[model samples]
Target: MFQRLFITHPASVGETYFEHMRASLGTAGKLARASAACLVHAIVPGLCKTTGSTAIMALHSEIYPRRFDQPTL
Candidate 1:
C-alpha cells in the first residue's frame, strides 16, 4: 500500500520518494513566492512586475521538460 501510494509516481518520474518530496517542496516554495508577489502586485500595480507569471512559466518549463524529456534506456 505504501509503495503504491508513495513510491509509484516518483519511480515513474525517475525519483525516489524522498527525492520527489524535496523537488515537490521546492516547487511549492516557488509557487508560494509567486502567490505572494501576485498579492503584492494587486495592492500596488508597480511592484513585482511579471514576477508571478514569470515564475509560473519557469516552473512549467522546468517541470514539463523533466517529465517528458528523460531518455529511456
Candidate 2:
C-alpha cells in the first residue's frame, strides 16, 4: 500500500520517488514565486510584467516533453 501510495505514480511518470518529490517541490516553488510576482504586478502595474506568464509557459514546456500516457516502470 505504501509503495502504491508513494511509488506507483512517479514510476508511471519515469521518475523515482525522490526525483519526483524534488521536481514537484521545485515546481511548487516556482509557482509560488510567480504568484507573488503577479500580486506585486497587480499593485504596481509596471513591475514583473511577464514574470508569471513566462514561468507558467516554461513549466508547460517542460511537462510537454513527458509522456503521461505511457507507463515507464
Candidate 3:
C-alpha cells in the first residue's frame, strides 16, 4: 500500500521519493509566487505584468519533456 501510494510514481518518473517531493515543493512555491504577483498586478496594472505567464512557461519547459502527455510510459 505504501509503495503504491508513494514509491511507484516517483520511480516511474525516474526520481526517488525525496527528489519528487523536492520538485513538487519547488513547483508549488513558484506557482504561489506567480499567483501573488498576478493578484497584485490586478490591482495595480503595471506591477508584475509578466510574472504569471513567465512562471508558467518556465514550469512547462522544465516539466513538459518528462513524457507526461503519453497515455502510458
Query: Highest TM-score: which candidate?
Result: 3
Error of 1 at 39 (Å): 0.3
Predicted candidate 2 versus true structure: per-residue lDDT over 10-40, tens digit per residue: 9888899999999989989999999999999
RMSD of 3: 2.5
Q: How many residue pairs clash in each candidate?
A: 0, 0, 0
lDDT string, candidate 1, 1-73, tens digits: 7777887778988899999999999999999999999999999999999999999999998988777554433
Cα displacement (angstroms), candidate 2, residue 2, comes to 1.8
- The C-alpha stretches of model 1 lying farther than 4 A from their native spots are 68-73
- Candidate 2 lands at a TM-score of 0.85
Cα lDDT, all candidates: 0.90, 0.90, 0.89
Name the candidate, 1 or 3, with the larger lDDT value: 1
- Lowest summed lDDT window (length 10), candidate 1: 64-73
- CA lDDT for candidate 1: 0.90
After superposing candidate 3 on the true structure, give the runs of residues whose Cα lies further than 4 Å from its correct spot.
69-73
Q: What is the lDDT of candidate 3?
A: 0.89
Per-residue lDDT tens digits of candidate 3, residues 1-73?
A: 8887888888888899999999999989999999999999999989999999999999999888875543332
